[model samples]
Target: MSWPGGYGRRVLAEVDSTNAEAARLADTLAGPEWICALRQTAARGRRGRPWANPPGNFAATLVFRPEGDARQVALRSFVAALALYDALASLTRAEAALSLKWPNDVLLSGGKVAGILLEYPAGPGGPLAIGVGVNLIAAPGAEAVEPGAVPPVSVLAETGVRLSPEGVLDALAEAYARHEGALVTYGFGPIREAWLARAARVGEVITARTGREERRGTFETVDDDGNLVLKTAEGRVRIAAADVFF
Candidate 1:
């Protein structure tokens, strides 16, 4: 269940459902870098929708039991996004164009390249897990996406980057270490700066989706509380958890 060195415990070589397995382990087995990976897992996006986690694609969960509050735990999504951005940067020349959509979706040239899902226990002071899925190769079909939802893309085999899922995992963990230090010191501000530096153009009209509600508006910047600011025709709005499309 454990790998040598700082590498996480590899639960199985499943073709489906890494998140489910990791979620089960979060209560008992997960420590720092307690990982569960799947060669192929079902894609469930932010709003209870299916994602495409095909073979050769990246589907894994990185569990962290930080001694912090919900605020810090929620900030893990941003930290994970930064880690992924750094990993992809090492693999491609189009690194400058990478951006973090609100919440924790990673975007490359306007299409979704990766997503981060944060899962935690209901009560206080419990462990938490983050599920990250990147399109290393092949995207979901139109049937898997909502009618108006934005299309998606992959990194490997498309960005001229030949990366195995393990390679991505390694690079991401290293990147997370660097940002985690900053998180411990200066809080999410410093990490958010790094995220915005790679983000797509803000203040542009786009669609934002939470599980319950959806809206179209101009994208504002992320506030200090990590909430996304949207300038809708209705007014300026803040979304606590939602998938952003720009």
Candidate 2:
């Protein structure tokens, strides 16, 4: 498969982190570019947790100048999630086993198969980098994840479908372009509907946790501003960001 036209692709044998690489290259880029590394010596996940990127797994970052306010640019997490969902489904041919976890993780058979982390520039008015990691051939052991978090699973481990990181990137880049086009042209309405359809356990109880607090409630809808809405005993709560646990 080929990457969509006008998008740039780069494959590195190794890097400290793809997100770091994106930050370095963002200034030089006139268009969107994808950076994939075969081996990352150091990678970080949400809340600065260490991300385990095995030699054969998929670790990549997409860098582009975004439009709209902070909330709008942040909505691309959903954009990236939906793209990753379709990309994995298409490549593994196991669409039925896949579903999206809120705020940014992809699940397969109830186990985490991939994750997306978005990073904004340190300086003002700069590009955004969306880093994506997938356990293509191998997943870190359960010990690496947080307590009560979904166990990690790989595409190869679950589906017996072998794929290289670049192969996945080809499908992913194309899928992202399609979803991103919808976001840019029609607004978040279509993307929100599509994401909700693939969402996991929307009507069920779930817990959203942050460093300072935790909230448990029935998963409601994601609001127009991309906040996770939950119906709790106290009231309907909208969370802008948190680690969601089912």
Candidate 3:
């Protein structure tokens, strides 16, 4: 399958974090590149939450130089999530239960089966890394997750079809290529529509927490800039970064 920017690919037996490794290789790599790890000793999710993947799970990162403002580039997380949704929907019999959660998560049967994380350098117009972790064969139990984090699920559990990590990676790479191309050609409008169609909850009540502040509101649609639009009794709020809960 064709990768974004025709970048190189590497699969490793182990790594600290695919995002970190991608950053280290950004300067040397010409364009977009992918790094997949069989296992991660120091995996992490959004907000530095420790992420531990079992042997059969998938951990991969894509490093690329985007051609736009840093804020625009950050929206690639949504694209990545959509790509995963597409891959999972095409591969699983339980497609009806699959949905994309706001910001950066894919839900299967109301449980999180995959997540996307985006990272960039200190300044703008530099190389950015997109990290994706899929619970293909196994998912951590409740004891392994954070106190209030969403419960996890695996594709195998949801579909009764076991998929190898490499198989998932190949499908992900192809799906991402399609969505990334769409984003470049059409813009965020099309991507937004596609995402909203598969969104977990819209027009539902939800809570968003960031730092020490919390806001409860009706979950509205995402704005053009990819901010989560929330309608609270006080007023309309745009959430750029927060942990959303239903």
Candidate 4:
């Protein structure tokens, strides 16, 4: 797919994972806003989990070598979520209700529509890579998604959205540049406004996983550090990581 900006996309018929492939090329690739789109991907999703990437579905990775700090990494995910949201919204009025789940996940009327995975290389001078997967033609089995959570949704011929994987990829890159520019120039103050406009909700009960025990609380706000602030029974809390839900 072609984008008007100085952006470019490299197509892959199939790959083990776009994020992994991008990581392999990080040192050699010189392009700043490089994107890799895969027709099929194996073992996708954040935290190295598996996501069903059936043929003809959307699977892609966008690698960015930002002139920003790790503290500003949340902007990457926010821009990604907004891009997907705007694309889907433009394609279908049914998707007008799309919202963003904190950190990174796209929700269509409260059900998951897309998921984003951000990878930051270890050590200094490492850039961030974001992997995004959307159920274009098919949703995953219940066993594959978060348990006891909202059912999944998709955008494809089935949803009457008539969107193609290539179209989504194009939209992602274009939308990303716009939002990322806003973030870099204006800081998170404005990005947070755009995010909150489509955010899941405040005061909604959620559980955050931290690799240890789970913390349950009401969603508060996005703190200055980009961490999610959850208001528990004790007090407001900051969460660096979590599998959130309402």
Candidate 5:
């Protein structure tokens, strides 16, 4: 349960949202910090969707002052995704069962197992906060998910391996540090390659809904800038953000 050198850790009995806490602490952080909450009363996911965190599930946020523009900083989502894939592979030894969904979701046996939500920065070089939530012990009921959204699964439910929030954080923090280091040193070339290797539905037909525009296409590859590249009936499309469906 050790973080890599220089990373900070904080654990609380409860929090409204780790991302919210990170926002409050972002300005004062001297270095990267991982904050974990055993219970989140008001947790949330991307686009302000509600995130359910059961007692033993994992909910944490990593806050840091990153040196880069929004484009460069946005690449950390892929970094985090790869780190999550590695952490889960090590924890469950089910590397074959894990896959990285484009943008920010982790799929286990095709079920949504974890999610990443990066807070939109206030400016070019503003501090960044990345919120991650994993279903470790219990997943919310399938009925809780929106129509067409992937149903959730927990590590215990899927792998029969129960774990505490702290244990998951230990693995995640270390994994994140490793990928983040590569991003800082090698730029996104290596990270992109690594992420694409684990990516889901690269050659399959999928639907991407960004706002009111719904585009259907064969999933191509994530571009260097992290856009979703799709081969559509109209033509090649590069989407910066979208809700993908298969």
Candidate 6:
């Protein structure tokens, strides 16, 4: 698929973080551009978590401006997760093991294989930077991740298929174009349904932790606005942001 607005593509040997560079170029660039780096010295994930930037893995960010209400832009994370799922399924032999974890994670064989992070500029109406990192050739060890974090896996380890960073980026770009189009033309209803179909653990007992407060209940369905729905003994609760665990 073609990139939105025929935006320019830039590839760098190294950078502190592609998202940082994209944020800097957002205004000057005419349209959304794809920024890819061979290595990131200070890469980060959701909530400022340090992301491993091994040379063989994929580290890329797309900088673009949203047309309408910016608050709804947060739903792009689900769109991105769907794109990543499509890209990985095209290469993996264990297709059945692939599933999308809520919020912003892609799982392979029940282990984390890829992650997405969306960042915006200082003020409103600025470009949105979508950062994606895939464990292509090497997965991080227990020591590299946070304490009690889910174990990570790489595409190579899971499917015995080796792919270059550029190769994965090509597939991702194509998949993103298709899913992004679906979000625009059909609206969030279609995207939400597609996401729920591949949901990692639906209709199961789980816990969602947001800061100090923790809520435990049966995982219901995500709402129209993308908030997670949790059915508790007391009543139904909607979580705008939280870390979920099974």
Index of the highest-lDDT prediction:
2
Output the lDDT of residue 221, model 4.
86
Candidate 1, residues 1-246: lDDT per residue as tens digits? 123355465745774566666666666662566454556556566655677777677877776577677776788888889988988888676786677777788888677888888876434566676788898878776566667655687776457676687777777777777777789988878987877777675757888877688888877788777888889878899888776655
Q: Could you tell me the lDDT of residue 55 within candidate 6?
A: 94
- In model 5, state the lDDT of residue 178: 91
lDDT of 2 by residue, 109-169 (tens): 9999999999985554579999999999999899999899999999988999999998888
Per-residue alpha-carbon lDDT of candidate 6 for residues 160-221, written as tens digits (9 for 90 to 100): 89988777777788888788888988899999999999998799988888888999998899
* Model 1, TM vs. native: 0.87
- Give candidate 6 misplaced runs (Cα > 4 Å): 1-5
Cα misplacement distance, residue 153 of candidate 2 (Å): 0.9
Each prediction's TM-score against the native?
A: 0.87, 0.98, 0.94, 0.91, 0.97, 0.95
- Point out where model 2 deviates above 4 Å: none
- In terms of lDDT, the poorest run of 10 residues in model 6 is 1-10
On residues 25-126, what C-alpha lDDT tens digit does candidate 5 reach at each position? 887889999999999999999899999897998999999987788889899999999988898899998899999998999999899999999984444467
Stretches of model 3 off by over 4 angstroms after superposition: 1-5, 121-124
The per-model lDDT (C-alpha) reads: 0.73, 0.93, 0.86, 0.76, 0.90, 0.86
Worst 10 residues of 4 by lDDT: 32-41
The order of the candidates by lDDT, greatest first, is 2, 5, 6, 3, 4, 1
Candidate 5 achieves a global lDDT of 0.90
TM-score for model 3?
A: 0.94
Report the C-alpha lDDT of model 4 over 159-185, residue by residue, as the tens digit: 567567777777777777788788888
